[model samples]
Target: MRKIPNNGNLKMTKVAYPMGLFVCLFIYIAYIKWHWASATQAFFSITEAAAGARRGQQAQGPLGTTAHGHKVFYGIMFDAGSTGTRVHVFQFTWQPGETPTLTHETFKALQPGLSAYADDVEKSTPGIQELLDVAKQDIPFDFWKATPLVLKATAGLRLLPGEKAQNLLQKVKEVFKASPFLVGDDCVSIMNGTDEGISAWITVNFLIGSLKTAGSSSVGMLDLGGGSTQITFLPRVQGTLQTSPPGYLTSLQIFNRTYKLYSYSYLGLGLMSARLAILGGVEGKPAEDGKELVSPCLSPSFKGEWEHAEITYRISGQKAAVNLHQLCASRVSEILQNKVHRTEEVKDVDFYAFSYYYDLAANVGFIDAEKGGSLVVGDFEIAAKYVCRTVENQPQSNPFMCMDLTYISLLLQNFGFPENKVLKLTRKIDSVETSWALGAIFHYIDSLNRQKSWAT
Candidate 1:
């Protein structure tokens, strides 16, 4: 390079170097400022990527609204049942009062076919896919990475043909990634639907001595489903309170306290009604003729056990009377003699009053009667009260497996229970969030990130 000229006796000019560097530094800082800004702060950043973040902040569109009053999390949940599939979608959020309480955006039922093992998994996939697509369209917001679809299978899955079950699950997994959870509806219902969240937590705490499980020491919970029923129990805990919510304002809970509990999933409560229809002895019987069969106590004044009984029933949408007391006595007698569980342990437990109709009745919808004059069977919510003489006679037993699956163990762990001690509680809430599935999916997705992990 040829020197243009010796300026001021070869003194170097600072302008060229400093001026160029200043321009470069200005550009570099601008770039860093733009790209380094957090997604939450992208609006203030001047980078192109920051602009991309700002796109998520566009003012409420003509027909759309922000979920967090900012961004939204749209998610899917399925109540897979034997008779049909119920799908629900929601925008997960915890900004209470900021957004409308979740209403079922979409409730769809897909009926493929009837079999213990569903042979129509392939056929059902399209319905589910359609439902999913509709869910995306209905959510109104596009940000949903935080809320993944929660897929659960209730009792119907067991009846599904093995190949069909595997294929359906595989398809769901492929479509939803590791986010799909195939769980029992009973599990999902209690976790999400009833006051079961508090109930489960209370029971778990009572068992560990962190809370009290006392009183009649007879804690029980009954959850009825379309295909089955679950009964759980531990020691009952009683407390006296003057102020509480409307229902508990002056109420008694059966399983007020928790203990090492037991949970039994019966495959035949609601399904049995439908299944019995196929049996000749149960459904093929002749209808009652006009000739009345009168006995010595048929008179109104009769005081016999089965006589002078009045039954309240609805037929063809009309409420009518039948011999309910007789019907109840007969039903009770059958249950007392029937073998629900074969194990000596289960068989030995005292027969508490039947919480058949009321216990968890709402989980499943009302059962309908058949055309052949079949008895309309619904899950009766009843709480049985009985002395456990036979159970006491047997050897002491450990808690049931279902009790080990509760969220209490995790809460206890968070509460400083050693891992060993926590494990003793026999439950590990599936990844804090899993414990809250379809029923609580929205709530958990909205709150999980904010919750401090126990270990942390």
Candidate 2:
């Protein structure tokens, strides 16, 4: 027989079972919430720490100080050229009592040079500020105050009227003053042709490791820009110093040493300017009555337009079945005669040609386009003849090739470089640009350091 269960005891057992299950479920949920909250806190902490570290690193400087406690500095150089405006942000490492080493360089270029805004000075601000922004991006914010900012106007502004050039420079100075970089009264000046030559000499010599030691022979510099061409070398012979015409020699003091350099810049003799002169077009002047410029340097069948200094002109080749090279050479001679001062000293110096010299040679396969190569002075003449012949046949190819090649050949001869004289042509050396910008910045920094020492 089944015995009757105790009613009170059964009721108590049912109630306690549900209560115990509820308690266990509540504890499990609490544990999960605690774990999640802790994990989230840890994740946020890690993120904040990483951001703080990055901020600290930036404050220290880009690339920071060297192992020897030497400081790393920066310089911003704006090359206001005839063709374009270029900014070079140079990272340099300096040790006490040693020449600064260019660790790296950042460069960018914009077309329509500073002189393009001669009539409207305010319009040039945007391009100038754009290039400065590039420098801001490449350089760390901490170093901006110490870095020197300079813009050296080349033939572009040199060709401008004195008052107009000053206005352009004053505008640049105003922009520079508003920036974070160091600016001086002389910061934005038209670099004279002589100074331009000397600076280029410094750049080439420093890059080739010639400036590190005393009494080492320095290579000569041949720079052909858009509006002018410069030839500079340290004269070894006493006769060179004595015979050099007035205004052809300049004495430069750099790194506590003086260099009496034979440097000359031929104004209106640059490739582009020469092109205008060759085409019978006057600078800063449009063709008379919009007349077309006809020359034998171009193929007889070619007709086109050429622009220089913001002036455009219609150009065509003369219809003549003549020796193109000879005719072109005759015209180039007429432009260069009595203009270029010939010196025998250029023959003995190991010379390096740059700018249009390199460009023209590379165009005709006379040298490697990228790596650059050596060629004899006569190579230009030979290439000119070949290109002229090819132009006569092709006619539609590079119309200016015949003219440019012929001009370079004759120009080299005018400088006293013989047919067999070898010239090393390159756009860069040791991965650094062969330009006056670097040397200009170097000199400017050196001057600042000297001034600081004197003040102390």
Candidate 3:
């Protein structure tokens, strides 16, 4: 879960978890406290240092534990997705007037997502609490109250009935309140699709150090998951922004800089959801009392059971004479119709794609799963055609691979990427897994800072 730098000569050992995290956590807190030195110092004189000491408790620590006398801090972010729930516990180190840098991350995941327990809110708590325990283990006991813990449910809960989703979040909040970690009113919630896409973009650009550079152009991000897919990028062309439809573009201000980006999330366009749609089945619904879901995208005689969101579906290939690839492509196109917004600027922008996109490419030998690699947009097209044709004849093989690959190809085309456009597929960039959680933590901290006026 933790990615250590290979170039660092610092001696390392297995015992460096909580202690290491403790130091890092204090550094970040000190960084924040240092920023509020003016307000903290003024209060130290007017109201005594006790008040300021309490405010800077986690942010300021002994100098021997930190390099620049800056405190380290921790953030706990839970990614509650359609397929599973995951915990990302991050430790950051920072000095005064400097940005926090991630030093370590402890991550874990559990199956049968929070959404799976929609019918029973009580059943979801054990899983949520298990993830929280990960934070408790890694973070020092004294720092728990200073650490902010949050859980953001994505498409899984978003697709659930509004009341059910809210109930699940409330249950999680109850659990959070019981934990020692700092929690707030905004600690538990369902993330909006727009925010999901934009946060992922922030993560990608942040990792690439593009956001820190004065004039460096940021790369775009494409995140394909189990229940939804997101595409976000900064538009370089003025016309692309001006001519775009509302909600397709969002303005974000971070660290005194504003960025207008093109971002959108298609909820039902994720790989798993696309499989259900292409197989002529509705999400979260039984198919007519054991009726089968038949599609040309599978082996002609292929009949099998596919499980999604803890429900199994009886699925098989159609017996029609229509070309499977042609028909499947058409079906995917229908799903894409009017659901995706495009900007010509994406044609010239570089992109880093992850999640299901990286998984599928890695499975098909199109790219390295771990090391990641670059490929043309046409690579997916090529893989789709071959897999669809081969799987058509070899029905017993992975029948859904063809459909999933084809849908990805078409999805990219729908996003205005040309066949010749190149994209990078990766799970981790620079030893850290690229995800929206990091961006979410930064955003959460920004909000807290605004509340206390620490970011001014």
Candidate 4:
């Protein structure tokens, strides 16, 4: 190597040093590329997850777990009715690709209704906030932001003037916005008469497990609220759909099924409203010169004060020799004449009547107050005649018993329910109240999910 080194050895050494350097450079570059790619993938994954959360694509995990490892959720619905405002806090659970299960329901009610504050919209805030507190107490802290909160006004706000109703709703929206729960632009609204009927229909069918299966025998819903009465049934006969009056047939979509139902809400035909009408008093208006309202439905010896729609009136029975049921029936017939559209299809459908129907039936021993029962349309008539005779001979505790029974009996007949037609009366089904609140909330959640899907 010292003198005249071999030419092949020198050449080999020179090439080997550069080749080694090039190999080291390639390895370093490859290491850097691998780390950068991994970091970029991680960043995108986090970004996508955050975006999904923002879109209400909630994480599926054990955070709010139930039996079968189902994820739990909640919905808060405020039913602003003519008589009162009720809050329904519902805890629901569901697994992937399944219908939600109603695990628990917490309900609270406050009196005098939101419409009581129509003149003073600000006064409605306290009651709404109180109900919201009930929801907060029932639902977990983690679900506050995830839960859907809504308030639906029924006939109470529907009867109000447009401007007044809007003001009250706006006040409610303000309170909802300040709360931690999820709120939307359409959170507070007055449900139209048809929608009210459809919602109750949904509630009854859903609670009975009919909505879970296709082609299941579905029952009709009859809800007699204070200010309105609803009759809703799924029509199986083509004659019903073709013969139904305009505004009576409505389409309801739920759980991926479309239903064309025979539904109608008769305003001013509810128990309370009918009482006012039968007594010859105008709604939302005081009697002229503070006069008294006399009706044959009351006892001739009875004289008292009756308050309706925040107005008190002196009411008395007419000094007539006619039968109480006879006179009251005639008067109720007058009120109902041409007011309701009769349907023969109702005769064949199984019906569940609630609200005032349940209250009246329970009051008269027709059904158990807690458990509820069934009654024939004729049962109401018989109860009416019996109660009428009793009221005629004695001072009754409930002065309107005779009148209410007669109205209900005649109301059913008018709706084409024969005397033998059986109706199941209940205030609750499966420990949950049989009201429009549950159904309305379900529909709302469904719509929200649909909207989110569309956006994505």
TM-score each candidate.
0.45, 0.84, 0.84, 0.86
Q: After superposition, how far is residue 279 of candidate 3 from its true place, in Å?
A: 1.8
- Off-target runs (Cα >4 Å) in candidate 2 are 1-69
Per-residue CA lDDT of model 3 for 17-64, tens digit only, reads 768899999999999888799675563343223223333333332110
As for candidate 4, its clashing pairs are none
lDDT (Cα, tens digit) per residue for candidate 2, span 102-126: 8899999998898999999999999
- Residues 1-456, candidate 1: write the lDDT tens digits: 985877864445656777789999999999888776664354233222321443433222111223325443455676565565556665432232343233334555576422222444455656666666666665533333333466666555654446766666665555555323322222222122223323333333333333322343332333434445444444232221221123322121321222344444545333333222211112222224412222211122222121110111111100221442232233333432342332222222221111122221212222221111111111121101111111123311311111111111221222222332201111122212112123334333433433433336
lDDT of candidate 1? 0.34
lDDT scores of the candidates, listed in order:
0.34, 0.87, 0.81, 0.86
Q: Where does candidate 4 have its weakest 10-residue lDDT segment? A: 54-63
The candidate that wins on TM-score is 4
Query: In candidate 4, what are the lDDT values of residues 1-456, reduced to their tens digit?
Result: 578779899999999999999999999999999999987656445433542332223333212443355666788999999989999999887675766789899999999899899899898888899999999888766567778899999988888889999999999999999999989899889998888888889888989999987899999999998999999999999999999988888888878788999999988888888899999999989999999999989887789999888889999988863688898899899999999888888889999999888988998898999999999999999999998888866656899899999999999999999999999998888888999889999889878877776999
Please give the TM-score that candidate 2 achieves against the real structure. 0.84
Tell me which of candidates 1 and 3 scores higher on lDDT: 3
